[model samples]
Target: MTERILKPGSTLGVLGGGQLGMMFTEAARRMGYGVAVWDPDADAPAHRIATHSFIAPFSDVNVRDRFARIADAVTLEWENVPAELCEWLERGCPMRPSGAVLRVIQDRIEQKQFLSSRHLSVPAFSIVESALQLRSAVDRLGLPAVCKTARSGYDGKGQWVLRDASDVKQVEHILRTANAGRRWILEQFVEYVRELSVLVVRGGNGAQCVYPVVENRHERGILRETLVPASIPLDVAETATEISKQVVTALQGVGVFCVELFQTTNGSLLINEIAPRPHNSGHYTLNVCTVSQFEQQVRATCGLPLGETRLLSPAVMVNLIGEEVQAVTSGEGLYALHATAGAVLHLYGKRIMRPGRKMGHVTFTASQVETATETARQFIARIRRSS
Candidate 1:
């Protein structure tokens, strides 16, 4: 495809005004591009940062038309945007990553099928459209498997892990309550030694760049921290890089693709899931890389040259969830963290907090990866303590 660059001073349309959209707006603005954001929430983070914000749902045709008419090119910050809405936008203006990618990713079964079709390794999974299928899947996958809704699951929601014999009834009950009459997938839980993610950016011209593999830690199925230059064998990291490139290429993906992987104890890697936007794992790049994932997303989607992803320092990123926010504000921990020499704090400016909702993150760089990891973990522990 010929490159049709959306130059600086051009308006870039962003769908979904979450934190990722907020950061993407900041990046585009810094690069001299104007941004227009569309989200249902009036007070969304990106709405405050964007040059123009439409507080209308993606399904609103008027808003979609206005957004397309204004933006030189459109890019989405989240995948849950209706595929039909994306297709409608494509008729008037360019949409990066394309609606095709969203169609596959918005549903778990489709995503897993896409991966399998591309010869990539994913956990053993079966689509469950009925109770009989669920029972069959459970019997085949055995105990300790997970049942997840096929669509709209994020941050550990819309999923249940079955650990033992008695959990089968609980799974049936939960599925009946929450996912009745909807598609779902039953997957055998993978026992992995490391949970890793790779951020890959692909330009319109098919040029690509990859960030260092990130090691992620999750508590209650939400990301808590990320350690850059994850301590893994050189070969393992190389494998992840190759697999990420393959996934992006197969999707014909443009913009940042966050590919999550599972590294087993025996050193084999399996594709866990994919997020086609700037991800929480890549947040550390903002402080430690030559160019951040957000900046790269702007470049990749706007037809600019992809930037260098070289790491400038070993860093650790700790997420600030709602509970942590309360702990920090109620104690001296926030002040102490602010005073820390190497720590960089980033708050999302969220007005309300839920138990596991991501409110912000802190990145700290150290001479060594171990030091960075320990410092980030310790700081989080300190901040989570009460006064």
Candidate 2:
């Protein structure tokens, strides 16, 4: 079947209204497409700029029906959005990535199993339905393993690292007191050399474009910075790229996807996780790439031709977490950041800020990677001192 191409002026529906959705909405609007954002939070950033907005729970059948009636094509900014909702939307129009894809990627156990079954390299993991299962899995995977909820966790939430017997006992007790039938995953810990990620955009026609591999640094499991063109051997980069493309193609996914990987001490790569939408690490594309991940998402969703993934410059993307946003939004810090050459600041426009919440990001671009890296380091240090 020929894919239906949604032309400009047609309304595009996005399932979540966070920063990713807001950016996708901006990109669609720039390309002459109207955007309808559906997020339960009325204060979600995308809701403010959306041409149409649906502020209702995903379980609300009435809102789902109304959204299905108006949207020409549908995509999502968050994987946690109910797969059933995507399945319902699919009956009306194209749902990029589809509900089936979500069901696989949203659950840690299922995602690991799918990748492992495909012979793709992934961390050793076992499913946990109860504390007893957790202990059994730990006996196999051993200490220092990580335990995470099978669903609905991001940016360090719903996770624990069991480094010793005490940690294991505490986590087991936490699990024991939790709701019945809830699932978790125990993964063998990887002492990786560096964290790396690649963004892949696949179209309905099976054509794909991959952005440059990037190195990521995390602070307490939250992404602190991303360095474009990860400083790895050419062979390693090629392998990472190949693995990411293979994963997305195997899923039959038709949207922007981010594959997180761990480069172990042995120089082999292990799949960490996958995100089915534009990722924080790819934010550098906003300033350095010919087409940002958000724009690629719009194109893939609308069946439009995918854009070029050319890198315009080396860049460092630093996320503004929680109170860090205050340092850059006003006063001398804001002025200093604005004055820095090749630096671009993007604020998410979220109303409330709390610890660990992602508020915005800054992208620093330069002709040389070292220059961008040094400038970003200096800026980060300055902010830390102020905070």
Which one wins on TM-score?
Answer: 2
Write model 1 residue lDDT over 1-387, tens digit each, in one string. Answer: 778888899999999898999999999999999999999998789999899989987778787777888988889888998888887787887888789888998999999999999899999998988766778898898878988989998889988888986776777766666644699999989899999999999998989999999899998889989998999989999999999999999999888999999998777899989998899999998999999999998988788889999899999998888778665554477687777768898888888777888988889998899888888878877775651
lDDT of 2 by residue, 4-25 (tens): 8999999999999999999999
Give the least accurate 10-residue stretch of model 1, judged by summed lDDT.
325-334
lDDT of each: 0.88, 0.95
Model 2 pairs in collision: none
Off by over 4 Å in 2: none
